[model samples]
Target: MEKLFELSHQNPALFVDILESIKDAIFISDHEGTTLWLNSASEAMCGVPKNKITGRNVRDLEKEGLFKPSVLRMALEEGKNVSTVQTVGEGRKYIATGHLVKNKEGKVIAAVAHLRDITDAVKNTSKLQEIEELLEKYSAQIRKLTSTKTNINGVENVKLGGKSNSRILAKKIIEKIAAVDTTALIVGETGTGKSLAAEKIHLLSKRRNGPFVQINCASLPESLLESELFGYEKGSFTGATSKGKTGLIKAAEAGTLFLDEIGEVPLHLQTKILHFLQSKTYMPIGAREPRNADVRIIAATNRDLEQMVEEGTFRSDLFYRLNILTVKIPSLRESRDDIEDLATYFLNMFNEKYNKNKRFSNEVLKKLIQYSWPGNIRELENLIERLVILSEDEFIEEKDLPQKMVEQHMSSNSPYISDRGTMTEILEEMEKKMIIDALEKENSTRKAAKFLGVSQSLLMRRIKKYNIQLVVEESKTFVK
Candidate 1:
């Protein structure tokens, strides 16, 4: 040790050359925490030159909560080495190690520390976590496909039928997952058969015979969601069932758990979910032992999760995990070619459900093709159900459809309206039509504004401009 110190003093340039060769930042500080020496790497790490770091107290570099005094205390007083993962310089992560340096008398003289950048390692870890989540999702989907009983009650088996686009997309997804296990995130507007795509993935996976559980994250509160997903012991909390319930995760053991509307899951819960996706295990509420989960996870959401991540609502790590094998379901408006087939399928489905043999009139078919269905297949299904139940004649005509749908047809067919009108006029007409349509569809301007893509003030202005009559509540009216 004496010989080394002599060499360092006599050949300070050589000593600095050795230290600078290391990729990690290396520094020496006196017992009082004053910086004595630092290598070139320190300049790169701290964004300051070695000359600036020397003759300065380490504490003066105070970077918020990073580089706690406790670390230096441990190296100096305890005479021990310490290591921790810390964020440096605007949140860049580093693995820092500190060690004490002793004099000839065995008394601590100074402390030395090194910091290695681990940003890439952190990023790779995040990607691995995502891949694991995708695997779990696929596993859950396999179980759902293999099981005969559907998870959703009262939802009859929907035959896999759609336009060429839907079929082609579905086939592509199935083919991709044929060999590997990866969690899949299905994204689309509401009612675009995202759930159906999830089911198909399960059916094609190796875990086909396992259970497939589905939950809507947006439909439940955070407190209740924890119990619903991870399950709770009996008397875990108020309103708890007597029989301790197994969480959907455990229930889906060796199967698949589908989390729909995953974007709505609370922020705190996201951390726990990230842990589960990484470890494939979780502790049940009020349970001490960690329960092993062999389930795959498939998550679906209609919201923009990446945007949510940027807004700090969704965890970036969790988002990456669920996004490994993303399948975007096209909106109904985007896939107009599929409308005729989907409409016909729904007509047949309702025909069987209602025990009625009704067909679409030529006028009704043309209107259906021309109309842009904002609600996708679910909307189409409801419309078909209404037609089958209300239409007395064997054929469904334009008059038998909803008032808003009929108005859309009229607006499209109107000679007074031009597609290429001035922006102001076009917006005005659109506002008027949307407000009227929303009121007709939902029966209130407040609710209409929510769907009309405009503010209530604007809707009211258009309503006045078009001289639209507001319908107050009339005598009790019922229409079959």
Candidate 2:
């Protein structure tokens, strides 16, 4: 130790180099709290050179906005170790740990502080909060559309309104699971009403009076996900909110906590979740003690948990715990028999909403049913609402359907040869057909350009390029 000290004294530049090599900023001050030296990291963090900061009192530097509530000053004043969150400039945050260096006589000789940059973690947490708020806003809108209301029995009824046998069986399974208070898993493809089913289960459960908090596990990064789920205490880490946060698990206290896309949870966090499931307790980020929560968990996922377990991406024990009461929701294609009813329901709902008397023509409805709805119920509802608001005619014709749907319905009669054509030829034919249809419907190049989402000059050029024949009458253009 004496030799090491002698070496440091002999090669002071080497010691300085070692201190400068550290990523964390290091600030050194005399017992009077006057800056003695600062490393390169400190200069970058404070946006000030060492020559300017040296010999300047910490109080003056604090006032000058280099850093607020100086840790070195606190350490000097208290004659002990001090730790605090320091703000440098407008959004950058740092954790500064300061300690007094004492001589052999117990006299404080200097104060040193180590600062770690924490801006990214703070920004990520803020972003996660914003995303959660936005998700809540959309969920509220969905609730309004689904008409979440209290019935005569005082139970919130979320109408999974469908007549298909598969849907009915899924609903029945959900109801049966809701009767018993246990962990549940809802399995289905995306847009197949997994979230809605989770809500229905929560409403039917004994904890209906409590809150139902739902979070999409896949929407956040792993760094933010753990804190969001279990929460963190105030003053626990740099840039944490002053009042801290109540995690989603705690928010659902006596009710259901629906974890959407549970398969996306990181492998490391799976252990924590499993522990919580087993003991009804979890430890928040930076927390010293475990906290208990009485919330029932309902996890939903499009990915097969069993397959994930086999592949080692998901924990088998956690999967087994969550799969206690499983409810599988069928996709819209699997329940095509209920498409007409579901479509009509959405149509009437949207018609009332828009104060329109729009009705789907039999042909349009037939076309809708014929198309394979890859996006499931959600897509169907969105299409119906769009038709209600956008269709000028009272009866929504087959032509009002989206171009992709129209093309799919008429693929058998399509002009482009699928097997014997180059990509360019097929695309050109498709473009020509779209231009002809738009010209016929709009009767004007300007209006057709708007419909086709192309500039007027570009549309004109395309017309000339394709050698499209146009019959002009007065100011209107007709497809020849």
Candidate 3:
């Protein structure tokens, strides 16, 4: 109240000391946007010394990456108060407010920008968003569980809980195909959960309340399969029951009939299966009339029916009919991110079954992930059950692993588990190492591509992406 402007002009050091004592950062700039002066708080917030920024223009400082978007410049250009959130260096955030200083004629001469650190607020906001997202995901899952039509249980839920993009896409595909009542084909490697997929589809479909009858075509002889699938009339053939038998198709009336290993069905029986798919009718042996059944068909196969069709084995027509709504489950090796989750699920399951408290050592689990699961999920499940039953120690260790896995671990150069960085980063490192090994052994890009089972263009792109340095000698490439 003692005329602050006159006091500042009389003793500038007093004003400077007063501004320096303030907690918030204060930056002063002339109307032309050149840095005039700033307090110690501004120097600390900007992570730069006062001398480095004192005489520089705001535009030059912005170009030098001091702080994004000069707030003083904003106040000078807009001729009004301005506020903005700005980022400095790597992770700090600040809320900047700019105000203009005017002369007696109301002409702007200087601009003062105040900055308040809001890095904590921004981090808390990001954390809150993540929590909300997690809540929403759980809410969606709860909704699916409460709805009977969409209720997926047992191994179905476990299979769908994969963190990989492929598994997430398969879950979406299952949900979509379940809504529509139609024939669905499940295709995957022998142990990749094709049967679980089919069962999940049946439970999620409109036929949840009805019986789900399953038959493995590969397990039955042609003569027996034909009789068991279509049923037999009374006194139909030798050894036939006096009373007619109900076939799987008829037993699953108003429900779903899961044909496991449909690709193994005989060519003669393929036509009959195609007929059932087309007309929803089949004839019982020794019956004069065709029997009608209200049942949905869900077929699964590890065999490539299309290739079989080309070889004159599986019927093309039947393959076409079942291929309309297909669900392809990725093998455990192809979806490595899901391996840990699946292994843990199987461990818990076998533990519960055997009434034992057992867990895998960290190294053992890493070896499981590193091993190429040719038998897919089935092999992993069996291995867990075996360990749960046979292992003398409570914790399954690396020594307890199979010989092949231990050999592979010894021969492999890549890390089985990530000590730091994300899964993606760990995978990239593995890929880089493999590429380098291939280049060293093959000594040529084309040969290396063949060894890696990838196209030359793809290998080149990956090499470029990883920034791998290669030394070429007489058309041979070497990783430097």
lDDT of 1 by residue, 89-132 (tens): 65677787778888899877888888888989888876766654
Better of 1 and 3 by TM-score: 1
Error of 2 at 403 (Å): 1.7
Query: Which residue pairs clash within candidate 3?
Result: none
Clash totals for all models, in order? 16, 0, 0
* Candidate order by decreasing TM-score: 2, 1, 3
Clashing pairs in 2: none
Ranked by TM-score, the better of candidates 2 and 3 is 2
Please tell me which model should have the higher lDDT, number 1 or number 3: 3
For this target, which candidate reaches the highest TM-score against the unseen true structure? Answer: 2
Error of 1 at 17 (Å): 81
Ranking by lDDT: 2, 3, 1
TM-score of 1: 0.57
Clashes of 2: 0
For residues 61-133, write the lDDT of model 2, one tens digit per residue: 9888778889998888887899998998675899889989989999999989999988897788888777655
Instruction: For each candidate in the order shown, give its overall lDDT on alpha carbons.
Output: 0.74, 0.83, 0.81
- Residues 3-28 of candidate 3: C-alpha lDDT, one tens digit per residue: 98788878989788999999999999
